[model samples]
Target: MKTTIAYLATATALVALATAAQAQDKKTLAIVVKGLDNPFFEQINLGCQKWMSENADSEYQCLYTGPASSADEAGEVQIVDDLLTSGVAAIAISPSNAPAMANRVREIAPDVPVMTIDADFLEADRDLRTTYLGTDNYLMGVKMAEEAAKLKPEGGTVCLQLGNVAADNINARAQGFRDTAGGAEGIERLAGEGGWTEIEGCPVFTNDQADLANQQMADTFIANPDLDAFILVGGWAQFAPQAYSQVTDQVMDKLNSKELIIIAGDTLPPQTQAFRDGRSHAQVGQRPFEMGYKAPDVMIQLIEGQTVEDPLYTGLDVCNQDDPGFCKDN
Candidate 1:
């Protein structure tokens, strides 16, 4: 009887080991983000790639693809379709829209689970999504408003440069910032006309010739030098120095007292450098890399028929020059 009991225990241990090994042998996952031109996405991709390589026991792979800019929804769609055809076990995406792509993702990868990161699709069918991993957009907006209010407690004309207003993520943030500061005394929201464009998308040679769109931004600032603050809905402030360099030498004195507090939604390497160099006031940062790192793991768990959470609300923090010593913490 004792020998039988020992034999049963040993068999159970062996089975458990074998199951663990099988779990590690899962196939690769497809992680499609918006664009790599932005360091935020690149950093996230790097984290995902690093985690996959380091965990050699896992047979997972990451299929990374996106356009040079986030505006290329067709390009993103093509990549997702291709990955679906290529037999990836699952896919993670920062989708362009909720209705348009959600249906297509369902049509293409019918059996596979789709996880939305950073940007969630509003019309996405519950069955198509295993989880939504990203920040609570409305809350972040409120946070931005609070920060912006602190800069101009009395409320002045605050201009908002909404980046990709079509994208729900940016829109939510813009609205959040608005709601946060809407009630403040003398606070006025001056909506600016602009969207997300590549930094290199518009480069200046001698800071004299105005790139059309940037010129418009400069004009707005010049017109409203008294504007209490300029809120960049995305990390659009990173492009400001280059834009301002166009007229700084001419109007340094004018800008000295203007006190246009610049606030942004996310932190990229350039934006981080901007804050360090005194170009921006504050940046909301997230552990963007971890999104890439965990994207595949979450997908793998779903593919293996293991239960995964329906949504994972990640966090983002604010960073300024004061916290330069802890850039990593941000």
Candidate 2:
């Protein structure tokens, strides 16, 4: 009877392993971003689909998801938990809050690979992720500063407009701006413009809220007429049709005439259209599609026993009015 029981247990163990292998073959990848309301994340979603179609031999599938905005840190964490429960082979997250997600990433790292794209965790929790696939955020900041300096060589007051000031990537970009164009070369930052709440030079969160972004933008331009330029580190306003109307009516002409310069991040259709129509000046375009495209490739690489030699950072292409090809193609 003991021999019979042992044989039955061994057979059951083999069957369980076979079942787990089958599940892995059918496992889906979750590409989670900060929010879904924006086109950057949509490009990421498209990129994933495109890649999967091209790599049919890999047999990998992906699901793109996000919360309402970049401010929803808890919502983002919950998405990760949900993906974990759903049995994803791997997870690629563009966290709204890196430090906040560190523990969660750490908790699941042993079971499956967890990597970061776009924004990354603080140094202490950096190892929680299997790899980081995005730009050197600080370099992106430096690039923005260089472009701003190039545009307004005469130097004037500039203010920052962005989302989620608490993010590490946001702070890194802000610091990069400080290091690159923190008013050292005669350009003054609009210090506490009109006594609005200031955190890393961004008074209003915008929360990716079009109306609020437009309102804050109009107020900033109207409040400080001589405000010279805007460095939208996380360019949230340009997404909405109604967004920046007042700024366009009142301030965009300055941009068109080269009197006022606006440099934004993330190039989407809205950005392309605005640049074409002279609503905004230039975009320090972060390729969300490319980031999205690489995300699945990276995850599949790990899933299939391939190695990541480097972080696989995306390029920051600056699409001014002169070149909207990238925008149109995207």
Q: What is the C-alpha lDDT of each candidate?
A: 0.61, 0.70
Worst 10 residues of 2 by lDDT: 192-201
lDDT of 1 at 179: 56
| Residue 142 CA displacement from its true place in model 2, Å | 1.8
Q: Mind giving the per-residue lDDT tens digits that candidate 2 earns over 1-330?
A: 543444344335434543554666856677888866666678888998888788766656666776655556677776677667656789888888777777776776547778888888887887777788887777787777777767776556777766775577776776676566654432234343322112344445666556677777787877777667777787777877566655677876688777778777777777777767777677777877888788987887877777785567787877765566566554
Name every residue pair that clashes in candidate 2.
Answer: none
Clashing pairs in 1: 28-61
lDDT tens string, model 1, 35-119?
5445567777887878868876666666555555555555566656755775567878887655566778878755787888877
**Which lDDT value does model 2 have at 119?**
81
* TM per candidate: 0.75, 0.81
lDDT, model 1, position 142: 74
Off by over 4 Å in 1: 1-26, 123-127, 183-216, 237-258, 320-330
